[model samples]
Target: MNKASRSTVYDGEVTWQRIADEVGLSRQGAKHVYNKAILKLQKNEQLKQYWVDLIIEGRATKCD
Candidate 1:
């Protein structure tokens, strides 16, 4: 769900509804989940690398 949400929303593409559908959720539900996750990652020093890793992996996948 994060991957789907990030790929679309991060790229300025619409259709979070589609991602929510794929994950059996509403658009707001998906956004809420993602928002919480992002906030948590930003707040945590130890887990910050995980956020960076996610971004790197995402970019890598897009490049491929």
Candidate 2:
């Protein structure tokens, strides 16, 4: 959820609809991705930076 969380953290907004539109995903799909990220962050404490970098890269690549 790096991109989605970036919306809230950096832009002070959490527009899932706009994110979905920009990345060509359904709104629910975007939310699903974000939720999965959340679970990962909570459950996988080790290698946090690795997962974070991966998430940011995914966002940079437009969720590809």
Q: Pick the candidate with the highest lDDT.
A: 1
Residue 54's lDDT in candidate 1: 86
List of clashing residue pairs for candidate 1: none
For each candidate in turn, the TM-score is 0.61, 0.54
- Per-residue lDDT for 38 in model 1? 83
Query: After superposition, which runs of candidate 2 have C-alpha atoms over 4 Å from their true positions?
Result: 1-10, 47-64
* Displacement of the residue 63 alpha carbon in candidate 2, Å: 28
Best TM-score goes to which candidate? 1
The residue-by-residue lDDT of candidate 1 on 28-47, one tens digit each, is: 99899889988998899878
lDDT per residue for candidate 2 within 1-64, as digits (tens), equals 4476556533347589977976689999999998998788778777577787987996887745
Evaluated at residue 2, the lDDT of candidate 2 is 45
Go through the candidates in order and give each one's C-alpha lDDT. 0.79, 0.77
* Worst 10 contiguous positions by lDDT, candidate 1: 4-13
Measure candidate 2: CA RMSD.
9.4
Candidate 1 overall lDDT versus native: 0.79
